[model samples]
Target: MNEALQLLKKYWNHDNFRGLQAEIIDSVVSQKDTFAQLPTGGGKSICYQIPALLQDGITLVISPLVSLIKDQVENLQKKEIKAIGLTGGISSDEVSNLLDNCLYGNYKLLYLSPERLQSDWILERLKNLPIHLIAVDEAHCISQWGNDFRPAYLKIANLKTHFPKVPILALTASATPRVKKDILEILKIENAVVFEKSFDRDNIAYMVFEVEDKLFRMVQILRKNPEPSIVYVRNRKSCIEISRQLQQSGISATYYHGGLSSNEKNKNMTLWTSEKVQVIVATNAFGMGIDKGNVKTVIHIQLPDSMESYYQEAGRCGRNGQKAFAVLLNSASDYIQAESQFLAVLPDKEFLTKVYKKLNSYFQIGYGEGIDESFTFNVNEFCAQYQFPTLKTFNAIQFLDRQGIVTLSHEFSQKIIVQFLISSKEVIRYMSLNPQQEETIVTILRNYPGIYEIPAHLNLVLISKKANSTQEAVLQILEQLQKKEIISYRANGNDSTIIFNEVREDERTINRVSKFLLIQNDLKTKQLESVLKYVSTKNECKSRLILNYFGEQKKENCGICSYCITLKSKATPAIAVSKQIISALEDTSLDSRSLEKITGQPSDQVIFALQELLEYKVIEILSNNQYRLRK
Candidate 1:
């Protein structure tokens, strides 16, 4: 224990470990697989990060969010620790170099998205690294029954066979009893040490306001609070519109969504974290892995997909132990919108097959032509070309994934650069000889660096800033260079990776898969219903309800809940006034009317006489040129 504390103090600036951090670390040190169900703000990262630093070899953290992996790697690097991240958008050569560094270099941590586990190269390379521990972030995603399951997560259980000696640490902010069991069984952890933290925040005042004008209500809350707050909306358009509205009202605010450039997201997040922006209005994409400690409020503008997601997002507030608020403003249509989103993603076999065929045609691929052939795709253009609904087409793609026909992954826009191999004057002379293609080649050669090295990664923001141009213009110039064969540029694109298994369709096989997909959809709908229940619950303490949902039992109700306030109000009644007190006010301005109103006793004779006189002087007169109480 003392040694663990020393590591905690040495690595991080903390004197002691909070909640189950010590126990979680001890379990890893003792070579026991562990499962931890810590609530938000419970320091789950420290549980794995600290042990990874103290362990014998590298710790591989499998996370679902690629953006989160990138952030974590950067943070670890800032701490003077060697960390490598394996995610899409990096070149294949960069991945090989990174994996080589992890295997041979002194890297303590390696973060990878679950999708990377499917790569054949990754599996081959894993056998060479001296792995000490496996940390699964958001482990609940491994369970098909869980709210946020991914098929890639299911493949993680095979790690036990690859590295039998290393201990595993599974972490999640929210998971039900069933999901908990599923995670444990799927991971094949035997008698894993369990650490569950209570989900209660007495400092947060949970209020549900039934409102029609959600945007106005949100603005009112921000105006009154005047603290760091987050407004969660349902869609990307809402994030943009609400953020604009808040700015128009003179509040320091910004919007965040998955659609924005990575640089834009980083800039907005920095502004909010540095307190330059008082509020951030965003979709669900905004809050994961954000570790700001001074957020005073989390206001939900629409119904979230699940209670787990809502609690995690809402828990971002009041981390500094100050008073904060979590308010949910809802209307009738929000429930319908949420329900429709769930249903739309679950398609029948016929619809799925048709969508798949249409997608192939849209991409201009036939039979076996597209196998292992990668190309940039424009979703809007593809949809227009195929004459299909974008939303429905997207949902159909997800369903096809469940059928195991193809694997889908989101892509990000990244820049590329090359180092100068020849003199700039020589290149210009060469361009003069071949003007048609040489001009484009010279343009790119002068623009980017490290490109001479194969599959080099470049910072698009820095490049654009240096070029004094928009990203669109930079991409157009790159495209022209690619066309001239002076440079080969992979256009930065937004499309899911489609790996076709190309299974021959059988009606029975399709039916079985479609039925399974529908069942999963029904389960998702039930999860959303659970979120609605949390919002509508009025008879229980909000804190107690949340705690109990996460499998914690509290002995008493939090005295600060709306339910407790209602009970207190019911037990106490308005006081009566005493007549003797009314008679004593000899110099008061009241004439006959006050004298008659005060002298008559209603109930509890002594109380009524005193109350009537006080009410008459302070309350009644104040309303119609009333008397003021001097402090």
Candidate 2:
């Protein structure tokens, strides 16, 4: 523990650990398998990283996302730690060299995605390396019951057979009781020490607003807060549109999604992180492994599919322990749309079989073939070719991936990169002929150390600033350089990827998992239904509800949430009438006159209650003007 503390101060420059970090670190350092459930910003990395530094060999970290791996590796490198991240984009030769370096070099940490474990060569290399500890980030993904279950995570269990002596450390931000059990069982950890930090974020005040104009409400919230904020939307189009709208309204904002190039993503992230941008409107892809501690607000423009996702995302705010807000702008239509978009298109067994066969045909794969083969997938084109509904087709693919029949990766965008093909003397001679390109080339060379050796991710914004030119002008100069054979440039491109994990026995493969697939669909439907319930329930404590969903029993209400605040607001006769109407309609439907007679209230009060209920979708008005509970 003393060595661990000294190492922490040396690398992270922190004097102490936060929450359960110290306990988890002590357990791992003592060579015991440990499981940690910490909230966002709970400093989970240090629990394993400090131990890795204290030990002699390297720490093998299995992460689920490439962005996360890249971020951690970059941070570690900035601290002068020898760390390497093995991603899918790297060539086989690069992987070999990286593995060799880990074996022979004094590397402290090596991060790799779970999918890479499928390679026999990689596994053989791992067997030869001196592994001190194994850390699994986002450990909940190993559970089939988890929200973001990846089939590849199941392969992580094989590590027990290979490195039986190495201690294991598993970590996640959100997990239910069942997920925790599954994580331990799937990882084959026996009698592991479990450290659970409180899931409650007392500094963040949760608020759900039922609104008609979501954008208007969002603008109002932003104006009131006037701090670093993140607005989470449903789709890429919405991310762009909402960001533009915010910018038009004189707010410094940017948009981010999986479709953006790596350079663009980094640029936008830098703008937000450096406080150059006041707000970031993004899809769900924006926030993982992001360490912005002073985010004052996190607004969800659309309800997420499950409580796990919503909790994890909203927890991103207030990491610095100051007061912050987690607001959900919702409408009745949002609920309907969420249900239709996620629940309605759940593919059945027959549909799954058809999609499977079509997918194999699309890839020109024969029966009992295509195992471990991956291809660039265009969902729109495949749906168009088959005359199928795009949403249903996507859902079918997702189901297949979840069932381990296939592995579907998110849309990957190649980095915008440039490499100089000419020598320094050639560049100088060309610059003398074309003075307009001189500034851009000079700026690139000054900013990048080895552009001539390999293609490097170039920042057009920075270059434009340094070269005293517009971004368009900088891009044009790079294009000219490419045309003149002075440089090689590659623009960003977007495409989803799919790997067939099994052979192409369409029905036989899918039929075996059809029942399990239906169970998964049912679970998803229930999860979404829970979200709807969270939004529609008017008087319950918001914090308690979310905590209870994660299996935390809390009797006290968080007095800061919107629900508690509204409860403290001056109550009127109409509010009491509305509650009465909701209670009355909970069990059976009743017309206005019947409700009025049962409650012994005036007709006017009954009318007001009915109107309020109808507006909030708490009760639906039937054809005969009778009222019933919605859903």
lDDT of 1 by residue, 254-302 (tens): 9888767665787888899889999999988777677677888899987
RMSD of each: 11.4, 8.3
- State every prediction's TM-score relative to the real structure: 0.74, 0.79
Local distance difference test, each candidate: 0.72, 0.85
Model 1 CA deviation exceeding 4 Å by range: 1-16, 88-98, 116-124, 366-375, 398-516, 562-564, 568-631
Evaluate model 2: give its TM-score: 0.79
**lDDT at position 599, candidate 1:** 52
- Against the hidden true structure, what lDDT does model 2 obtain? 0.85
Model 2: weakest 10-residue lDDT segment is: 407-416
Highest-scoring model, lDDT: 2
Query: Model 1: what TM-score?
Result: 0.74
